[model samples]
Target: MEHAKPLLNYIRKHVTLSEEEEVFLCSKIDYRKYLKGQYILQQGDISTTQCFILSGCTKMFFVDNDGQEHIVMFSIEDWWTSDLGSFVSQTPSDFNVQCLEASEVIQFPYETIESLFEGIPKLERFFRKIIEQAFVASQKRIIQNFSLSAKERYQLFHSKYPQIEQRIPQYMLASYLGFTKEFLSKVKKELLKP
Candidate 1:
């Protein structure tokens, strides 16, 4: 019931749901509490569940051949996260999803989601819209990487996730922005100038 509110509100943003539908959906949701640095999904593991963050933060990242971690995205409260490629296809994931802070998430297993879609067709539209938004965000990040200066990228990131900036480690933030920690500090100093 407590976890239902956030998930219900998020879904309702993209689709209208009746009370019965809401109750049914909530019944299938499972909650998990993750400690900071704990992994939700690991590279090469199959992701069996999609999660909605009820509280705290998570980072989706991958280790490159050089053994460097590359952050693909971060999710905070009210955001959904999963290795969609793995969840949908039942294949190994290419990314690792880890908690950045002590976090609570509501999870929907892949089979449960499929069942929901089969029973509630409108839910499909809701998920489609969610995917569309994620795709657009990914495209924007790609464009920013190509077209924006490091400072500009930092500014964009700061503006979009001001709260997150203060919470995550500086080194992790630097990784997300594709810069070294020292470089990010320099950029911050420049931004602070009168």
Candidate 2:
């Protein structure tokens, strides 16, 4: 009930849902809890459900041939997390979605979502907009990686996700910033300097 507002806000940003429609949407979702390090979606597995963060954080990452994990995206409250490329296209996932902390989420399976959308065409538009936003975010991250220096990237990350540094490990943050731990520490110190 209390979680309804953020979910409603998230949906209404794309489409207005009547009370009946909101209730129908809520009925399609179920609350889920996950422990830190739990995998919501693993590479090579197909994700069948979409997760909305009611609280806590999750990261979607990929392991390179050298066995290094590169962070692709992070999801926190009001954000949606799903391997849409796999979930919608029915292909194996290239990345893993892992809970970064003990977390609570609202999970909606594909079938339920489809049913809800059939009754509410606007819901389809809402989810489409979410995918569009995710694509834009991915493009921005790609542009940053191609053009920004490691220190500048770290600064941009800090400005983008102030909570992630507090919640995630230094090594993981280093990986996300495309630097070694020592280098990231040096950069961090420089960032803190006057």
Candidate 3:
């Protein structure tokens, strides 16, 4: 019950849910915990659930043929993290979602989500709004990757997500910012200089 508060609050931000609806929704959710370095979803597996982070952090990324990791996104408390494509299409995921810390998440299985939409009509709109926001953020990130210099990107990312920047390792942050660790060190040094 306590674990559901964050998700309920998040839902209420976009739409109102009556107590009954909230109870129905919670009935379908599964609260799960993962150890640091454990995978929530791995490449080649179909995503059957959508997760809402209750506590801790996760990284979503893919490994290229050359075995280089390209981070797609990071999620922390009150954030949703999942392979939306795979969950929707019932296909293999190209990405892996792994815990960066021991994490607690609320999982709504695909079937449960389908039922929730039917049981709680407002849920569809709430989900749509969140997905739309995520999509817009993703598109902006794509544009930034092409147009922003590495240093500029790093600065923007750091300013926006200082907590995440502090929590993650230098190499992971460097990879997310699309630069080498050495280059990141150089960038930080340049920033420190007048």
Top candidate (TM-score): 3
lDDT of candidates 1 onward, in order? 0.92, 0.86, 0.95
Put the candidates in TM-score order, highest first. 3, 1, 2
**Cα lDDT of model 2 overall?**
0.86
Lowest-scoring 10 consecutive residues by lDDT in candidate 1?
Answer: 1-10
lDDT of 2 by residue, 1-194 (tens): 56666788877777888899888777778888899989989999988889999888999899989998888778888888888888888789998999998888888887787798898899888888888888998899889999999999999999978987888888888888788989999999998899
* Per-prediction tally of clashes: 0, 0, 0
TM-score of each: 0.97, 0.92, 0.99
Which has the higher TM-score value, candidate number 2 or candidate number 3? Answer: 3
Q: What stretches of model 3 exceed 4 Å from their correct place?
A: none
Worst 10-residue lDDT window for candidate 3 reads 107-116
Residue-level lDDT tens digits of model 3 in 72-147: 8999999999999999999999999999999999999998888999999999999999899999999999999999
Residue ranges of candidate 1 with Cα displaced over 4 Å: none
Q: Stretches of candidate 2 above 4 Å error?
A: 1-5
TM-score of 3: 0.99
The Cα error of candidate 2 at residue 96, in Å, is 1.0
Error of 3 at 157 (Å): 0.3
